[model samples]
Target chain A: MTAAPAAVEARDLSKEFDGRTVVDRITFAVPRGTTFGLLGANGAGKTTTILMLLGLLRPDRGEAQVLGHDMERDRFRALQRANFSSPYVSLPHRLTARQNLTVYGRLYGVSEVRRRIEDIARELRIEDLLDRPVGKMSAGQKTRVGIGKVLLNDPEVLFLDEPTASLSPESAAWLRSFLGAYRDRTRATIVLASHNMPEVEAMCDSVAFLQQGRLLEQGAPRDLIRRHGKQTLEEVFLEVAEGDTGRQQGPGDLA
Target chain B: MKASLGRIGAMMTRYMYLYQVSPIRILELVYWPTFNMLIWGFMQEYLRSATHPAVFAASYLIAAVLLWDVLFRSQLGLTLGFVEEMWARNLGHLAVSPLRPLEFVGALIATSLIRTLVAVGGAGFLATLFFGFNALELGFGLALFFLNLVIMGWGVGLAVCAILLRYGLAAEALAWGALFVLQPLCGVFYPVSVLPDWLEPVARALPATHVFEGMRTVVQDGRLDIDLLAQAFLLNIPYALAGLAAFLGAYAVARRRGLLMGTGE
Candidate 1:
C-alpha cells in the first residue's frame, strides 16, 4: 500500500526579527498519525518554528506545509483541518469555558456545536468547569479547557506547545494518557514543542533537538539515547546544551 | 478568499457574551454618552438664559451633543473590540484560528455599530425626556449625519488599531484619545467659521467637520446643505481607505515580527 502523505512538513523554513535570526533554515517532516516533538531550550526557536508551520508567522525564506497544502499559499485550507493549543496563549478570561468552546466550534464550522462541546467537556473531564469563567479556573483546569478548544473540530493535525506545563504530576500523567488514547482512536497527527524531556520521551514517536535555531539532532528517543551513550534523554540534553557550541553539531553527526 | 460567515458570527457571539456578563460593561456603554448629554443640555439652557436667547436655538446645542456621540461612541466601539482581545491575550489563539483577519475586522465593525446605536439611543432618549428636545426633529438629516459620522469614526478607529498593532499596549492611550484630537478641529460644538483664519481650512478638511456643519444647517436653517453632506461622504471614501490600508500594512509587519503570537496587555 502507498504511504499517506506527511501530515506536516517544513522545508528549510527560516525567520528573522529585527536583523536577528530566531529560526534558521530548519527542516523536518512528520509521518501521518505519529507524534513529532520539537525539543529546545528557551529562546531556541521551537516556538518560532511552530508558528511558521501554523502560518501564524511569515517565514523569511522557505516554506511550511500541512496536510499537503503549502502553509504560506493555502494555510486556510490546512487550518480548516487543523488546530493548535498553547499554554502561553489564552482564551478570553471573562467567557465561560463552554462559551469559549462554542465560539471556537462555530468558527471551525463544526455541526451540532453544542453536542460537540458537551462531548469534549466530558472527555476532558471538564464538564463541571465548562460553565465557570476561564479566569476563575485553576491553571491545570484551564489547560484542559484549552485542549478541549483544540479538540472541538477533531483536528486532523494538532500543534501543541508545552501541553502539560505547570500541571501536577498526576494531572500531567492523566493528560498524557488522554492524548495517547485520543491519538489511538482518531489517528490524528500531533506536533509538540516542549522543554519537558520526559514528556517528549514518553509521548513523541520521533523527536528533533534544536539549538540556537538550528536542527542539531533528530531520531527516536531510544536511538538518540543509545547513540549519545547516555542513560536518559535528560542527560543527553544536558550534553547537547552545555558540552557543545550550538553551531558545531549537525543532525546525527555526533562522533 | 472564501470568508466564513460562521467564523464572523462566532466572533460576534464572543463579544455579545462579554457584553452580557459584565454589568459594568453594559452600564459603561450608556454612561458617558448620557453624562455628556445631560451636562451639555443643561449648559445649553444656561447659555440661552445668560446670553442672547435668539443667537442660537435652544435645541441646537443639545443636538450637537447627541450627534458628536455618534462619532465618539463608534470610534470607541471599534477600538474596544480589538483592545479586549489584547487584554485577554487571546490574539494568539485568534491568529491560529480559521478566522481571517478581514473577517475579524468585519466582526469588530458589526459590534461597533451595535455599540454606537445603544449609546446614542440612550443619550437621545434622555434628551427628549429631560429637555423637550428630540434629535429626531432633524428628520432625514439625522440619519445622513449619523451615517457620515460613523464612517468617519471607523476611519479613525482602524488607524488607532494599526497604531496599537505596531507599538503594542504602550501605544494603547492613542485608542481612547485619538479622536479627541479631532474634536476641536471637527467643530463638534461649534461652526468651522468660528475657528481662526489659519485653522478654518484645516477644520474643513475633516469629514466630521462637514458632518457637524451639515447638522447645524439642519437645525438652524431647517434645511440640509447638499454640498456639506456630499463633501462628508466623498471625504470619507479616502479617509476610510487610508485607514484600511494602514491597518492591513501594520498587520503584515506584525506577522513578520511575530507580534500576533505574543501581543497582550
Candidate 2:
C-alpha cells in the first residue's frame, strides 16, 4: 500500500539562541488532511517549531517543507498555500474589522474579496463586528475575526499557535468544532500548538509531546495513553512531560 | 510582478485606512510641517529686511523649510510605518503571509512617498499663503533635489529600521534621532564650506549636503548646478544600497535568533 502524502515535514530541525539550544534536533511528519497537535509546556519550543515551519524563523540546522515546497528556498510559494492564526497576535486596532479583513484578503490576492469576506463573516457569525474597530471588540469576537482572516486565502495548510489560549471553555469548544468542520470540509492539513490536553485529544488525529526542545513521545491519544499504562491522555501527558519515560512502554509492549 | 503590486497596494490601503479612521493621525501628519513653515516664514521676513542678500531672503528660507521637510517626512514616514505594525503586534502575521521582504520594503517606500507628498504639500501651501513665497520657483531643479533628499532619507530610515529589528524596541529612539544627527552635517540651512574644515569632507559626503548646496546655487545664481545634482545621485546610490543591505542583514540575524517574535511593546 502507498503511504499518505506529507503536508508538512521536518528533518533534524534545530535552532539555538545566544549559545543556547531552543529547538533540538526534532523530526516529525504530519500527513495531509489531518490535524496534528504539538503539545508542550511553556518554553518547550512549540512556537519556535511553528515559526520555522512557516519560514518566519530559520532553523539553524536541518530543513522543512510545507506542501512540497522548501521553506527556506521557496517560502513564498509555500506561504501562498498556508495561513496562520493566533489569538495572541492582533490585527491593526485602528481599522475596522472589515477594513482589516479586506487588507489581508487583498494581501492573499483573493478574488471578489468583499464577497468572500461577507461569506466568512456569515460563517463565523461575526457580521455585526465587521464594521466595528478591532480594538473595541471582545476577546471572543477578535478570535473569530482572526479565524476569518486566516480563511480568506482558503489555504491548503493552517498553522495555529495556542488558538484557544485566552478563550473561555464554551468559546474554545465552539472554535474547536469550527476547526474540525473546516478541516473536514476543506481537507486541509492543520498543525496545532496547544497546551489544552482535552482540546488536543478531542481535535487532533495525532499528537507529539515536546519537552525541553525535544520530542519525548508521539502517537494517537489513545495509543499514547495505552502505551503509558495511563487511564487518560492528560496523565500520559504529565508522565511524558515529567520525564517518567521508564514507565513508558512501546506499542504492543503493554503487559 | 502583478502580485507584488497587489500586495503593495494592500499595505498602502492598510495605512490609508488608519489615516481615514482617525482624524488625529491625519492631523499629526500636517501639524509639524505647517508649524515649522510658519516659524521659518517669520524668520525669513526679518532676514529679508535686515540682510542685503542678492536672493530674496524669504525665498531661501521657505525653500529650505519646504525641502528640509521633504527629507524629514520621508524618513519619519518609513520609520513610523514599520513602528505601526510593531505597535499592533502585526509583524508576525505579516511575516508568515506570502508577502516577500522586498514587497514589504516596496510598500514602505510607497507609503513614505505618499506621506512626504501630503505633509510637504500642506506646508508648501502655508508657505505661499503666509510669506507670499512660491517654492515652485526653483523650477525643474526642485524635482531632482527632492528626489535626492528622499533617497537619502530612505537610506537613513532603512538603517534605523535595521537597528530596531536587531535590538528591538530599546533602539527605537534611533529612529527619531538618527536623521537629526545628519541634519547639521547636511548643511540644510547653510553651506558646506561654512562648516569646520575637518567636518567639510564629512558634510560633502552626504547627498543632502549637495542638495541644499544645489538649492542655494539655484536661489543665488538662478541656474541649476548639474555637477552638484550628479554628485548627489552618485552618493545616494551607494547609501541606499548600503541601507538595503543593512536591513536585509538585520532581518537574517533576527530570524536566526528568533527575535522576530514578540517584537512589539
Instruction: Name the runs in model 2 displaced over 4 angstroms.
Output: A244-255, B53-58
lDDT of 2 by residue, B145-205 (tens): 9999999899888989999898888888887788888889988888888898999999999
Give the least accurate 10-residue stretch of model 2 chain A, judged by summed lDDT: A244-253
lDDT of 1 by residue, B137-231 (tens): 88888899999999988889999999999999998998889999989999988888889999998998899999888888888888899899999
Q: For model 1, what fraction of the real interface contacts is kept? A: 0.89
Clashing pairs in 2: none
lDDT of each: 0.90, 0.89
Deviation from native of the Cα of residue B214 in model 1, angstroms: 0.7
